[model samples]
Target: MSDRRATVVRDLVRRLLDDADGAGTAPIVQVGHPVLRAAAFPCDGQLDDADLAQLVALMQRTMRAAPGVGLAAPQIGIPLALAVVEDPGVDDAEVARVRERDRLPFRVLVNPAYEPVGEDRVGFYEGCLSVVGYQAVVARPRSVRLRAHDASGAVVDEVVTGWAARIVQHEMDHLRGTLYLDRAEMRSLSATDRLGAHWASQPVPLEASRALGFALPTPAGPGGAAPR
Candidate 1:
């Protein structure tokens, strides 16, 4: 993230938190933003600042509000070198053992750089919040290596396979100003013609209750709300 944009986000988030009216929310620039076109600012030095902290907070709230599992700084029009990933814990050992393979645990990468280490593989059905109404099938590596600086600025190199690897690669692309659309072989805006299923699906909510916190059709029934 550029120091300039980071500074802006820090101030902006403070304003939003104080009022909480939601009027001070930052606008996510669409595909037309000049910042999205070319280069993403690199972290010049230590990322210790209010902006970095604010980015993390804003990203979390934005992701939750938008109902997405992961969100990056660039998506919100702040070109930062960080991303926030809320892990949906899955039984990885069972998944990997089923196929006789190994996969790493979930991680939150900051300033990550992805490089192919082994056989190359491609993927599709990537959805971007910036292109909200569209879904694109892009091809990226099936296995990859990542190098990044930790919160303390210590260099750490990691490796992984399968979807976990894909997540890092996808986020790293954002840090470089490249969207999955750039690498997509096929693109569509929600299964207009040739319909296909997405490899990764968005998380679905289980249920929604009203403001009164009562189950539907349950004022005095078996499923009625108990005394608080």
Candidate 2:
């Protein structure tokens, strides 16, 4: 969130916008990019409705193609306080019941922020489109109150629970240049491909913690199981 980083993000945004011409998917910015570490500019009045709509559509398309549940503007090199999220969910009833993950409709969040709703938290292996190929266990609040504006500039204020809340927090962190790794349990970090071979059966990080020889921070009381 340094001034230099912010300046770099702004320059990148301008360059990306200038070059946008109904082209193919905008390449997702990778983990080491300076723009990904910079706080984003607020979306208010930055683009007219038409441009904003176009940009949101582009983001949605890119996110869907990535097959990810959420995407932040900075992930695509446009450091604006905007993101898109959606989760069609998996068909496994057991996994869904444990993770508290259900289907979430697509949503566009502009200048979104979240507040932890309670003391309860859950640790789950989380991944990011920007930080592709790796996953790690990060503890997040079980629920949150989200405040933001939708694509139409309408106010959005709601309390989301379980997996939906996690998605919100993950995307909101991007606006502040915060990646999940910033709050992850480093010992539990694993390559995406190795998850099925090692940690897929463990509903929580406890087993992984024991296997990896690292202490897993226990959540406050019981709330929900870990992510898949």
Candidate 3:
């Protein structure tokens, strides 16, 4: 475990504390919950109670299920102004998670900030587990120089480069009550036409061939995703 590890529970903490009523009894949060979509909350002092810890667990589970690399409490309807990020890619530290990790889940965050570490920007397509059903093209900083808190309540700062940076930006937007749609600058072109023309530029897997029973052209590369 990293020295600055965000307080790991070894596996699932919920089961251990399931009967503990106060710290492990938080309910799952859903999209559209007033708490999930709130922006800019100050939870440093007011959010350390039992409900807060339970809420943290719920957010951790929700983010993992979304198959996300990191998640903020606000995204799961808890507007405590904090985020939980588990960098599975730390092992790879290269690609932006082409696949999810099977074990050793982590949540490292308290009151983290997403500051750009580099001036470079890259265009990438993004999808949201919350919005559902589609992907969009958007642009984000290729790397972000940021400082955030670890789960242990420690301030850990590192330059989040590459896909990790993307994850940070994506989650940060959620904290601010912003969605990918907020960053979408592309003209709302029809999905069918754009896909047809850009099929060769996509990186779709063969198993994902059909959308609504009709297949878009075979997804082909790094450029397959639309830029935001």
Task: Give candidate 2 misplaced runs (Cα > 4 Å).
Answer: 1-23, 217-228
State each model's CA lDDT, in order. 0.54, 0.82, 0.53
lDDT of 2: 0.82
Candidate 2 C-alpha lDDT tens digits along 1-228: 556755665566556655666654678989999978989888756566766777788788889988899999989988789999999986877767667788999999999988999777887789999998899988889889999999987899999987898899999889899999998888888999898788887666667877876554454344454323
Candidate topping TM-score: 2
Better of 1 and 2 by TM-score: 2
1-228: candidate 1 lDDT, tens digit per residue: 556776765564455545544323445557777656655566654345554555566666776677555666677765557766654545555434322233333334577787896555533345666666666545456667878875456786977665566667777777788877787644222441222343222221002122212232212211121222
Candidate 3 runs further than 4 Å off: 1-37, 49-52, 87-105, 188-228
TM-score of 1: 0.64
Candidate 1, residue 117: Cα displacement in angstroms equals 1.8
On TM-score, who's better, 1 or 3? 1
Candidate 1 weakest lDDT stretch, 10 residues: 203-212
> What is the TM-score ranking, best to worst?
2, 1, 3
